[model samples]
Target: MSFYNMVQSEKPATLLEIWEAISTAFTHNQNEQFQITDPRHGDFTVHIEQYADFSVMNNIYQPRQETLHIPIRPQVPSLLMSFCLSGKPGLSGDRWEASYEANQALFNVFPARNSTYVLPANTQHEDLVIKLEMHTPFLEEFTSDSDDQLSNLLYKATIHEESLHSLQGNLTIDQTASEILAGIQKCPYTGKLREVYMESQVKLLLVHQLSVVHRLQHSNKPDTTAKLTKADQEKLQELKLYLESHFLEDHSLQSLTKQFGLNLFKLKYGFKTLFNTSVMKFIDDKKLQYAHLLLQQENVTVFQVADTLHYGHYNNFSAAYKRKFGYSPQLLRKG
Candidate 1:
C-alpha cells in the first residue's frame, strides 16, 4: 500500500518527455484516476498538461506507511513554482530543510544538482506546480529591467551556478494569490483557449511572486538604517506568527517592542522587510480575512463577527471590511 517506489532513469530531453518519464515511473492502480507506469515508484495520482513554454503538474500523493523521497535531476535548467493547496511536503537540499504547508508557495531556480522531494507517510498531499524551462529565453524578452526579478534570478542561476547553487525560498501567498490560484484551477476555457488562459495565469502568478521577492530585496538593500541581523530576522518571524494567532488582540509598536525585547526601529523595519507589509496592515489583513470566513461559513451576524474580532464600532468594522474585500459585511452575508 506504500507509494514510495524509487526509479532511476536517464534525464528527460524535452519538457513533454519529462512528463512522460514521470508518468512511466509510478505504479498504476485500478481505483486511482491518475497513475504512472514505472513499477519501482509507488501508486499516486498525477495530471500533466503541457503548454507552449511551461507545463503544469497537478499531483496528489500518499505514501502508504513510510515517507517517500524521490530524486529528480532535470536535464535543462528551469524555474519551478509550486503552490501547496493541501498537505505538507518536506524538501531537503545541501543544508536546508523546507516544509511547504497548505496555502503557501515556493519558487526554485534549479541548478545541476539532484533535488529530493519527500512525501509524508499515510497522508494525502496535493500541489499545483508549474515548470518553466530556461532553454526558450522568453522571459527576458517579455520582462523589462524594472520588473525583472524573475529574469534576474534565472540569469544568476544560469551564469553563476557555483555562486548561486540552487535558489529556493518560500513565499507568503496573500488573498489575491489565493484567488488567482483558484481561478486557474477552475478555468472554464477549452482547447487552445484553455491553454491561453492557463498560460496567462501562470505568468500573472509568476509576476506576483516575483514582486514579493523584489520587495524583500529592496527592503534588504545595504542600508545601515534598515539592516537586521540573523537573530533579528528570527525575532521578526516569531512576532509575525504571534500576531497571526492573536490578530484580534490590541497591538502597538511600543507594546510589541517591550514584549519581544526589540528596539522600535528594528521592530518596524524588520517587520516590513520580512512580511512586505507594515505591522498594522498585516494585522488588519489577518483580522479581515478571518471575518470574511466567519461571514461566509458561521452564519453569524455582521455585528457579532465584528464584536468577536474586537471591532468596537460596527461602522468601523464595516468600513475596514469594505476596504479589504471591496464589499460590506452585510452585503456578503446577504449574498
Candidate 2:
C-alpha cells in the first residue's frame, strides 16, 4: 500500500488541520470536487464541506488502484458516522482493527492514537462521512448521562488515552437514509441555505441511525442471565450472518440447534442477548425489508415478492409487511 502520514498533532487536531494534510496531495476541481491522481496513491475524488461544529467528507475511490494508507495520530474528540455505500475501507492498530463493509452504517469516536486507515484497491469505494465535534452543542444532550450507552461510547475515548474506542452494530443503510444521502449529493440550494439544508439532513440521518440503534438495543429485552463464552458468541454471530444471507429459508429453532452445534436454550436466549431480537423475528424482519425493496421494482408484484421470499401465503406476507413498515406492499407499489 502507498503511505501518507497525516498532519501530526502537538495537541488535539481539528478538522481544518486534517483537511490541510489531505489538500497537500489533492488539487481543486470543478464544482468543489478535489482529485488525487498520484500514480503511487491510486485515483481518488474527494469533496469536503467544513462547518463550525460538523463536517462532511464525500469520497469516491476509483477502481484499478492500489491500497492507500493514511496513518492516524491523535485528534480532537469527535463522532464520525460513515455510510459505506461500496467497497471496504479499514482502520487498524497493533491489537484492534475495524473494516467498513458495503451497505453498513457505522459510527465511532475519536481522539485516536496510533491507528491507520487504508483505502481499498480493485473496487470503487463510495463513502459519506459526517463528523460531529464533541465540544459543540450538537452533542450536548448526550453528555448528560455518563452511564448511557452512547454517551459512554462517545465520551470515554476522549478521556482514555490508551484505549481505542469503537462501537458498531449491524445497522444497514435503509431506503430512508439512502434518500437523505441522495438529497445531499443533488442538493439544489446555494450558499447559507445549502449549508442549512445539509446540516438538517445530517441531523435527520443521525436521528434515523439512533432510532435503529435504539430499536436493536431495547426491542427484545436481552436475557441478562444468559452468559456466552467467546466461542458461543462467535457461533451466534456466525448464525446471524447465515440468517442474513439465507433469510428466505424456513428455519426451525431445532434445525438451527443441529446446524450450528448449539443448544436450544442458547439459540433461543443467547440470540436475543447478542442481537436484541429473536431468531425467527430477525429472519422475518429481513424478509419484510427485502419485500419492501422488491415492491419498488418496475414490474414486481407483492404476491411475487412474497412467493420469492418463500412466504407460505401472500396475504400473510402483506400483513407482516404492513406491521413492519406501516403500509402494505400494495400501497407501496401504488405510490
Candidate 3:
C-alpha cells in the first residue's frame, strides 16, 4: 500500500492533528520525525514543528518511478506557503490545478475543503511548507499594523470578500528569498536560539512573499502595459527552463530573441512578467547555484568550476559568487 493509504483512516482537523495521524501511521524515530520507505515511494522523511499559531513541515520525498498522492481536508481557514527548492509538485483541487517547480514559491488560502497534493513520479522533492491558521483576532492585528495592499487582500480573502475568489499565486524565488530559505535550512544556532531564528525567518519569508505579490499586481494592471496570452506565458516558462539547464552556455539578448522566435519587447516583458526576473539575471542565478553545488558536493577546484561555467576571468567569477552567496568559493569549498 502507498504511504497515504496507510494513513487515510481519519480526517485531521488541524495541522498538528495531521502530523499526529501521520506519526501514528509511520514508525517514529523521535519527536517530530517520521520516516517511511516503500518501493514505490523510495523514501520519505517528514519533520513537523508546531508553533503557537502556525506549523512548519519540512518534507523530503524521493519517488522511484511512481507518483504519490496525499489527501488533505483542512478543517479551518488557513494560509499555506510552499517553497519548492527542487522537483515539481502538483496540487489539485475540485476545480483548479497548480504545479510548483524548482526555485519557485506558491501561496494559497484554503477554506476548510478537500484537496490532494500529488508528488510526481521519478523525482526527488525537497520542500519547506508553512501553514498559518487565520483566526479573526490574528488577522485583525496583522492587517492593522501593515500598510501593504497584498496583506489587505489576504485579510479580505480570509473573511470571504466577494471581489476575490481565491488567494492563490506563484512567485519566482529571487536572491533575497533564496537567502532567507537557505538561512532557515542551514540554521547555525540551537535550542531556544534556533527556535527564535526560525520564527523570525518565517516572518521574513511572509513579508517578502507579500511584497512580491504586491509588486506583481501593480505591474500587471489592466491599463499599465503589454499583456501576454497564456501561450506566450508558457513559451516564456519554457525559455526559463532552457536557460536554467544551459546555464554554462553563452547567451545574449539577440541570440535569445532569435532562438525563441520572440521580439525584443515581448521577450523582455514576457520573461519579467512570468518569472519576475530579467533573462540575464536568471541565468546568473542558475550559474551561481550550479557553482555552489559543484563546490560543496563535487571534487573540483574553484578555478576549474569557474572555467567550466564559462567565467572569462577567475576574479570576475569569484566576485559574482561572493555577491550571490555572501562567501568566497574558497570558503565554501573548504567547508
Please report the candidate that would top lDDT against the real structure: 3
TM-score of 1: 0.55
Q: How high is each candidate's TM-score?
A: 0.55, 0.53, 0.59
lDDT of each: 0.67, 0.67, 0.70
Per-model root-mean-square deviation over C-alphas: 9.1, 9.6, 9.1
Q: Candidate 3 at residue 139, lDDT?
A: 50
Which digits, one per residue and each the tens of the lDDT, describe model 2 over residues 245-293?
Answer: 9998878999999999999988888787556679999999998888888
Residues 1-335, candidate 3: write the lDDT tens digits. 33454344333233334334453422222236555555533666777776666677788877675576667667666767788878987777788778777766787775566677777878888888777777755456556645768668667766772223222445666657878888987889988998788878878887777776666666645411225554555577679879878878899999998988788877887677555678998999999999888887656899998899899999999999999989899998777
Candidate 3 Cα lDDT to native: 0.70
lDDT of 1 by residue, 232-324 (tens): 766876898899899988898899999888999899876775565889999999999999889987557888998988888999999999998
Q: Candidate 2: list runs displaced more than 4 Å.
A: 1-33, 39-41, 63-65, 141-170, 221-335
Predicted candidate 3: what Cα RMSD to the true structure? Answer: 9.1
What are the runs in model 1 whose C-alpha is more than 4 Å off?
1-33, 36-43, 93-97, 143-154, 161-169, 220-335
Rank by TM-score, descending?
A: 3, 1, 2
